[model samples]
Target: MSAWRWLVTITRDSRSFFFTFATLCGVVPGVIGYGVMQVTNSTNPELEARLRKSARPETVMMGKVNQERLAEYLGELKQKQDTNDRYVAALRGETLTRKPYQRIQPVPKPSDTVTTKAQ
Candidate 1:
């Protein structure tokens, strides 16, 4: 067998070992770090005060939406889904049924003027 294929086979054969290794190396350290952060957040009053003072004021906005507006948003989402479906079909070598994309006009740049004249 080729070296690349052999390596892949070895890795596939040792999947459990890799899982245990990752759990020991990555997940354990991440859990420990999160625990340390939580302890610091609870124990350190100065840090907590500093964090609260710098934090943005929370808005009291509620999640209430009108039925008509919600329906309109759902319709827009469905139209986008249809466009995505057509694009995916075209990617898979199927004929496109949608109209040609419109050409975009170039954006005009701002012209900067200065009063300084070169001799």
Candidate 2:
């Protein structure tokens, strides 16, 4: 019905053929553009080396990212606490199996005092 629809129909039925043809068509224009730009190009190896050595920006960005991660960790801690509190609340009516144990003590002796130093 439309030019684009016709193009789509042709492309779908002959996908491999149309794709290669389209790629070739695109490459010709790109090669022409690159060839034209090649006449006006200059490169500086020193500038490239300096740019490669400038790694501080990446390290600073990582520092900022670590702060965000720390905040996320704190948020996760709060969620864990809420979950633990919920578990405690849910078990409020449940009986716990406590270990049976008792401390032993002897009857107190008559008041006694001992001197730490010779008197």
Candidate 3:
């Protein structure tokens, strides 16, 4: 029988068609993916070592807190709190004399005239 005739015959029966369709769409691709994974899979020793090192906990305990770092952190916290407070006050319709937050000014670019003079 011709290939097309055989395919028509198989498709006529629901059970046979389902088995054929499942094998073609599911099993075939699964087998192909398995083969590809097996062929392409590889291990890197350096990457493995790095992964192991990161996974392992640090042996050394944190030393005494540095007073300078603590002070700097506290100052940053205070600044953040002040900014948040100013934002909340503004939301409540309070008039702020000073700017809530300082805006970052763009750096002045060298003019074409300056570049021409330098050249």
TM-score of each: 0.28, 0.28, 0.31
lDDT of 3 at 17: 80
lDDT of 2 at 104: 22
Query: How much lDDT does candidate 1 score?
Result: 0.59
Task: Give the number of the best model, judged by lDDT.
Answer: 2
Give the lDDT of residue 54 in candidate 2. 85
Score candidate 1 by TM-score against the native: 0.28
Q: Which of candidates 2 and 3 reaches a greater lDDT?
A: 2
The lDDT values for all models are 0.59, 0.64, 0.62
lDDT of 3 by residue, 3-115 (tens): 97877777777787868786898988999999999988768788867766666244212222355446644775877744464456557655333233732223346678988
Task: Choose the strongest candidate by TM-score.
Answer: 3
Writing each residue's lDDT as its tens digit, candidate 1 over 47-98 gives: 8778766765542122133454466447758777444654455576554322
Cα misplacement distance, residue 27 of candidate 3 (Å): 0.6
Worst 10 residues of 3 by lDDT: 56-65
- Model 3 / residue 25 / CA error / Å: 3.6
Q: Tell me the TM-score of model 3.
A: 0.31
Model 3 residue runs over 4 Å out of place are: 46-119
Q: Alpha carbon lDDT of residue 17, candidate 2?
A: 69
What lDDT tens digits, residue by residue, belong to model 2 across residues 5-112?
Answer: 888888889979698869988999999999989976658788767765785988768977888757754775877733353245346543212222521223345454
